[model samples]
Target: PPEPPTGVPPLDPVDPRYIGPFRLVGRLGAGGMGVVYAGLDDRDRRVAVKCVHRVLATDTDFRERFTREVKLVRRVRAACVPDFFGADTGAEVPWLATEYVPGPTLADFVRTRGPLSGQALAEFAHGVAEALTAIHAAGVVHRDLKPGNVILAPDGPKVLDFGIARATDGTALTRTGGLVGTPGWISPEQYRGAPATDRSDVFAWAGLVVHAATGRGPFGSGTSDVVVSRVLSEPPSLLGVPVHLHAVLHRALSKAPEARPTAAQLQQAVAGLPGTERHADAGSPNRTWAAVSVPLTDPREWIRGAPRKRSWARRHRTALTAVSGVLALALVVGLGVRALTGEDSSLPGEPSGPGGTTGGSAATGGTTSAAGAPDDAPEEYRDLYETGEVVVEPASQDEPVLVRRLEPSSDGGEPLDQLRIDFSEAVSGEFVDFRMTIDLEYLPDHGSLTVHSNEFLGLRAITPGQENLDFRTVGNTGLLAELTPDDPTETVRLTFSGGVAAVYFVPLETRARAQESLDYPGGFCVPRSMSGVSETREVETFPGRDYIGPLDTTLTNGAPLDNCAYTEDSEYQ
Candidate 1:
């Protein structure tokens, strides 16, 4: 099995094989709501398939929200957003497919390549603002817009993952009682438990730009509690952020959501920035990927431009003439009408036009009716007007799930290098699972192993045992395990010696759900919806290979556990 693209990892035993007509080739990434896989359509075009976690899909409310949001997400058509292909919300394991963007995430790019600056930073700001404009125009609010959700594609920055997004009409999709967005990137209103709107996304957009300009978030890094407090009380530190963008970002990060500019206004302001001339030129297809060399000027000055100072006489001349004409007409009508009608002045109710009496049209300011005639026509031809707004019934919020504890330990048996994690909340089930991927190509000296859980783990629950697992070496590979728990995704990344040679999953005491089926004789079971067989079944037969086997419950006691082991050696020690 050949390695997939850069950020994409090999599909694990637990992953689905086929989602609808697309063949799942590799794992793009996973999150709380679902797992994203890289798949190929019948036309062989690559797409990203996002499948909701079984735990969440089982909830009727969640499925309804997923179904509704998918409709709204499809309405978003923007260059900065991934193109939506299709979805099956009613499937056993509901999944939606989108265009696969072959680019590193904004978080990964900033971590590996360093913070963006100059023209690259300008374009990034403009592109993200453009994405917000498209999303808001379609009546969808991107509840989560962190660095991880943004992909720095070759064409521009693409905003991905509308998994938590809801319509702008105050439709509550955060049924899970916990806060909807990531810690530092979340806006003040969201922290205060207010419903998220397009303005909330604008606030997030400012924080994202700040993170891109500087390597860190606007609120700074700390535990979730500390970060949340700072976001609520303190002003964002825009220190390393370019001076030109200070005013807009400061206003955008205002404590009051109403103070923030609308997405369209934000786009206009970003488009007016000094080095964003290329962005303003719509006809130019060849965009500059590299940083543009331009002097930093006051963004406010550019955005406002030069004010046209008009003389007082020139401004008031038109207004004075219009007022005089109206007064003269009123006086003449008053005198002539009385003389024509002989004091009563009330006209008979007679048909005044070819269609009918012109009274209705006069009352309606001479507006045309729905029948292509004046509103003065018969009442039967009058048109009933509506605001054209979609009324989405609000959803009730669900109780929040709190983590009682998170325990990490080594599997002291065969394949001693494997690590096992147990959550108090029963995170590993038929629908809920975890993902682990190793990357040894990018960094030469050492490799990295990243493990992500679909469940949310509190910082306090996992911090104490973090040091206990640091000394454990990964099998005979001699790689030390260092746990770096990511708050947003509940992920842990461990640095190891050299690169990853082989990855193996030991059989756990968990059984496949009724909706899943086994892929191979000894391979792990996958979703029944993805039970479609591929045309070719290739197998690897060597050491130092990326081998992810199925969790065979037949060989072990039914204890409901799973573990991952990595070793450079050909055979298990």
Candidate 2:
């Protein structure tokens, strides 16, 4: 057990195994204030055990706050939430246990894949909104509702981590002047030092909806300073958001809390979207998760050098809703519209993920509008077009289908500018074995370009940045690949026969640029195995130039690259 990361504290050597009567197994995840471990009860049922940082565990005030959270959990009666198992604030290393959910976080799902389709987005949003309603009904404010806090189980979405949650009637109140959450997920009221309210959760929930719809956060970046500034003064930008849920997200994440709908109201507003599965316990079958045990190691090595004064500060680097009733009468009618439509959109796959392409970028063609952008673009480029989607094939020991498509807009204005295809859940292989196809209107002067490709994995980590992408994990997941073009058909196809969790494809030229700027050598991009994933495809066009690029660094190996391209000096280069 390396010293826990910022949120989680190092385990006590004298008492490492038990939190009261629950026996600890191994860590499930680590965060700013605590470590969540897989633990078992006498019946052998597995539960997620969260241990409070020793510093806070010993503080009387923090103890009170922690206990309040326990009470709050008990009050929230929604079947969507995990059942509270127990809380032992008095232990040398205080801990709490809740039913364990066996699934990836919603953040992981979208990053590995792409945004949820219109129907899926609607359904997911509805479930989250309803969960928020239940929390508010408990008279507690969740305070934080970000992508990582949401778990998308086989059943539906389950909200987790009530550590910063505050009970309206509890004796403690936000530790007096302390800020209690991740910046991007904090509500405006939270930044203003106002006591949190149910509406506070609404504000954060709104921001999350925007993040889910687009691959970016409403504030544009997840940096703490940027998020704080955006929440305090910026208007929520709804451009590129999945059209069907635009109005709902706009209203929910409104700058003014008053303008936002209540959690219950939001639920009603998004009621009955497609692909939302309602499970009895948010996919926690039998209120337990599979148990796997691994030996724990001393965490001192990783944390020893951290300065004592900054211990708390270091931990702070880290850190939802409801539905509404409307003019209840009007809500009923509107809900019908939402329900009957089932999220209308022409795009293939989920609307929010990396698979779908919206429209022309601001670069090559200025002022082009996305499909749902109130209306279509001007006549000049209206005819020009492009389409993209993330494609996946179940794991196969042999070559897998690899296809690429690029086409100009209706009138042949600009070549289909930027293209990216993300293949998730594909295993990594020693060699990059895949085929590609590209077709485009002829370039004015450039010689016709043809491509042959190959991708490989086996490389060293970038030395300039954090070598350990997962700062707290026991080991790192490393990947490398190379692509070489070999065909001439307007329609190109290739196959990769290997193991990989997923594969990402971008336009050849765009990829060349990304490889150069990103990996430094200018032709390769290797992501650490444990790195967070993203599938965003951002295409921007200048008045006469088209450039395709990534929206954010979802697979950031904790290194800075040149505009998502690989640079010569980069480790992968």
Candidate 3:
């Protein structure tokens, strides 16, 4: 058998034979907490189990954090992270295991393969950006995003080590004045004792991108205080990075989090670098992905360079959780959440054996199609998944439906613009009975959205031969007609068919003057495919310009009704 990316280290005599239910075969790595061992289940499925030290296992705070880590992974359903199997946090040793992703860390990859440049570096940037996008999309911030935490598997880069990741609901595991994260990669806000938000992760992303391109981090390695000082004051060391990436890295490394572009935006920008191979124009055929074929069992991927463990969990092994009651309460409400699509769980026809990185660029409109769809197929979200519920409008020669929304007030006010979609081209056909998903970047706290058409704002239901067909959603158990300020509501997913093509947001309670800004939801239109396999093509941050009222005339000839063209909601105040 070929040696893997994370080589199996021989077990120490003191290591336990089993952590939880799996029988330990060998050790992968060790940290202050405990040993990470290669294990096997009764069926002999391989797993990487991290068993915590007994002394800390009994600690309530550590145990709770470990449980929270499990919860975090459970909620995150992204391909850029390791596949999660199971964890027994309550076990005496408290070990957590995941589908052991086989690949060298970014640190190891660049070190061995030499610094990545050209297309490979750009692809790496896109992969890590997608990983961060997935992490932030799940309401978590990866506080430590150095090269070590990034694994270069067969299927692009996977972001691991959620030990320091904090939920966006303000549920920080760290105490004020106390710090977390590695030195060089830590964001300026983190050094100043500000909270770790999505932008903080972006800053670290900038550092990691720089680090991956060149051997050293953007700030170079140093003692905590020295690195923190430079990170707060000095510009990033982007001398060796490609010139095209300079602008993005500069923006991402901005001292002020407000100035940073989002990971999704970064994915959009970096993937379009000059060296990246161009594809078909939008609405054109030839949807290809950027995939690498490093197998899980490849000896090159599994070669252990060194143990690189850096997270709050790894460093502060015995640290107590000073998480406030309010934060804890918020986390309880936000635990185990699926994003806008509600389809974070595994996708259909996942390529087994080797790393399952497929063909296509992350910048390409949507998610990568697994199988069944030939290259000549339509770019739809339905065909990508083997099983999942969605509603896709059939391809029609007539006018196509388009939806748009004005971003909420930058100051957190009411619905300043219109939310509308022209459903005049609503399709009715047996072949169109496919599932579709509309993913928004940010789902607001309250959902007062009302779907309307040229005729009415909301429709009752679609009647296909008097069957009363309704779009089925797996997660949105209740179609919330009303939401409060404390509501954990984030994603706005529409399960309706041709009539309600899109949703409009009207915040009922965005009260008080805003000292901080809110993230606008992401938009991506998944076209219907004959097969259930589809890709997640990202759309604009908001539909269009901030709070544009609406378009005066109707769109024509299959032209997209840009969000700016959408008229204001007449039913809304």
Q: Return the lDDT, model 1, position 264.
A: 93
**lDDT, residue 502, model 3:** 28
lDDT assessment of candidate 3 = 0.47
List runs of model 2 lying over 4 Å from the truth: 1-15, 167-178, 272-573
Give per-residue lDDT, candidate 2, residue 546. Answer: 16
Please provide, for model 2 over 210-294, each residue's C-alpha lDDT reduced to its tens digit, 9 standing for 90 to 100.
Answer: 7667766777776678778887888778777766677777776666678888999988777644434444655332211111111
Per-residue CA lDDT of candidate 1, range 113-155, in tens? 8998887888889889998898887677888899999988767
Candidate with more favorable, higher lDDT: 1 or 3: 1
Per residue, candidate 3 scores C-alpha lDDT tens digits across 1-573 of 223234466667776655544556567777644667876643355667877666666567767766776655545556677655666566667766766666788888777776776766776787788778876766667777777788777656778766433421232233432456667887888778788888988998888888878888888777877877888898878989989999999999999999999999998887678655534542111122233326545332322321221221112223212232234223323432222224445334321210111222111111234542223334442233222111111122122232222222122222211122322211222433223332222122222232211001111222211211122122322232222224322323333333232222211111000001111111112222222333332222123332112221111111123333232432111
Worst 10 residues of 3 by lDDT: 510-519
Give me the runs in candidate 1 sitting further than 4 Å from their true place.
Answer: 1-7, 167-177, 279-286, 290-573
Best by TM-score: 1
Select the stronger candidate by lDDT from 1 and 2: 1
lDDT of each: 0.50, 0.45, 0.47
Model 2 error, position 99 (Å): 0.5
lDDT-sorted candidate list, best first: 1, 3, 2
